[model samples]
Target: MSRGAILLLAAFSGCLAAAPEATAQTNTGTAIEAGGFVNPLLPSGPDPWIVRDGSTYYYMNTQGNRLAIRKTQDITRLADAPEITVWTPPAAGPNAQSIWAPELHRIHGKWYIYYTAAASGHDDDAHRGIFVLENAGRDPTRGKWTDRGQLKTEHTGIDGTTFVYSGKRYFAYSAYVGPDSELAIVAMANPWTLQGKETIIARPDRAWERQGGRQILEGPEFLRAPNGKLYLTYSGSACWSDDYAIGLLSAPAGSDPLDATAWTKTPDPVIAKSPEQDVYAPGHNGFFTTPGDRETWIVYHANPGPGMQCTPKRSPRIQRVEWDREGRPVFAKPAGSALALPRPAGAP
Candidate 1:
């Protein structure tokens, strides 16, 4: 055999032997088939964020403060994998406590963690901002992360993510406006600062957006459709209500995503709470591409029963994205009615 091939095979075989316990777990999440759909793989936490790096998957969520990290070659095993507390905030500061929506990204040969945090027990104190954590180590899964403080923006923001297009970098975030909470976006010159100005991207115009007594359009997530349209998805309504769901907006690829005028909001929500299956508060999601780009999947959080109490009951769930002929995103609920439905592919 070739020397290079032999070395690579030896390394993989060594990992399999060393982590036999991990390899032994084959589709253990309430499913009859191995690697099949299983919803609510994680029966706790919310605002799920997942990053698939090669065959490995790293996952996290809005656990209030503590930043948890789970690494597994197979995402299906994440349900049982122990989450390590990779980051702890300072004793006191703007990001001292109440961290939320932490998304990990590998940028410029370094690991960058984007998240929102605020002072303890203070909602008004919450700026809904973005902060960076850098890891210089080659393997992001094992590195010392240095907190880079908050991103510079004129207003409060959250659900921050970085996207690279046309050899340029940009940041997208969600925020509130006026008395009602709304999701918006701003172009960023760098990871730590917002450039130009903020643009009101989405609001609670659709019925699903106003699911509960209040209205909301937060958790801005940007993705390009197969046909090359810029699509933005946001969580809507109050998380305290079962009516909480997700909204969608779209525009041309070259259009200014930061310009409110350039984008268009769908009259109806693309994904919302599934009342039929008793899956409520289905929003705040992350997207991932399957190996070989064969499929696109969604990773989000939901309340299996009802109500919006953010506790151990609100766990992370995932499903595959089924697109319509019109080139829009359509979300599906897990099949079955007895307990919860099966999880989507690639989730634990």
Candidate 2:
């Protein structure tokens, strides 16, 4: 799609003026009373990661080359918020091709970003790895970012994310190991290096998986449950297939999360496409808390229609996360064919 069209779609997510105490009805048999957020917060692009720092929400996504950041205190305005070119690669290397899934993380009083960038013109060689950016400006919007090089790890990785448990830091990324594409993860000894060889933590072995001629799993986001278990939520099935959905893997707390052997995959998928909602390819998701810490949410992408051809069609979206009776993560279906979710909390 042309750059102009891409921007137009992105603007559609939240480009409307704030409606005053408006009410809307939906097929869900529920009424949105008013002052609630809408969906399809952004029109295009996939692999969305949002970070809520204090009262502000900063969002970034998969831009094939340059990094685009939207800063907003009131997330509902993210679609209308001006886009800023926060960081660009001065000299290209690992972070040049298909720059997919960029996430903002604040580590040790500094802003660190974990994104998947591959060698130019080589998508197969793509590794979702973590890279660091040091910002000196008191405000991220006013400061410049200095690229701190790439992190080293085994396997071709993408969707790099970091988690801290009990005082230890662990990095999680999605990669393929088998002859066919199967997603897995490994622990990092340090942010910049792999701890051990590597372990296959998750895979596409179920009937719901294996869409698009390949069984794939990616966009893994680690969430710690209230029960103290480490839940690694990832997208499975083919990106091009409407069957694409989210799944979960669980590892006990106080165990080695990096040790692939420690985690056990669930027998059934957790989140999948819902025809009733007309939502297809509802995966490649990240988790975050609202600004007021009132609720947890899932930020992901979906194709309004079936069959995923990477065009301006697939767009970023956000929804609130719910829990099952057993305290497992349960996500609802996409709102509808269009985007109507609330802006990220703290969006401008």
Best by lDDT: 1
Give me the runs in candidate 1 sitting further than 4 Å from their true place: 1-31, 120-128, 324-326, 334-348
Poorest 10 consecutive residues by lDDT, candidate 2: 11-20
Full-model lDDT, candidate 1: 0.66
Residue range 167-248, candidate 2, lDDT tens digits: 7777777665653345555566655555655566766777777665556677788887766768888877657667777877
Off by over 4 Å in 2: 1-24, 27-33, 121-123, 126-130, 136-138, 337-348
TM-score of every prediction relative to native: 0.83, 0.83
Collision pairs in model 1: 37-343, 38-342, 38-343, 39-342, 39-343, 128-157
lDDT, residue 198, model 1: 68
1-348, model 1: which lDDT tens digit per residue? 532222112111100011111122233454445444445667676778888777677888866657888887666558766788888887776787657788988777788889887654443423346788988886666779898879886667567887765456677776646546676666777666667776777677776666545566777777777776678777777665677766677887677667678788776656666666567777788888766666677787777777544455667776667666666666654322333333334443
- Going through the candidates in order, what is the number of backbone clashes in each? 6, 18
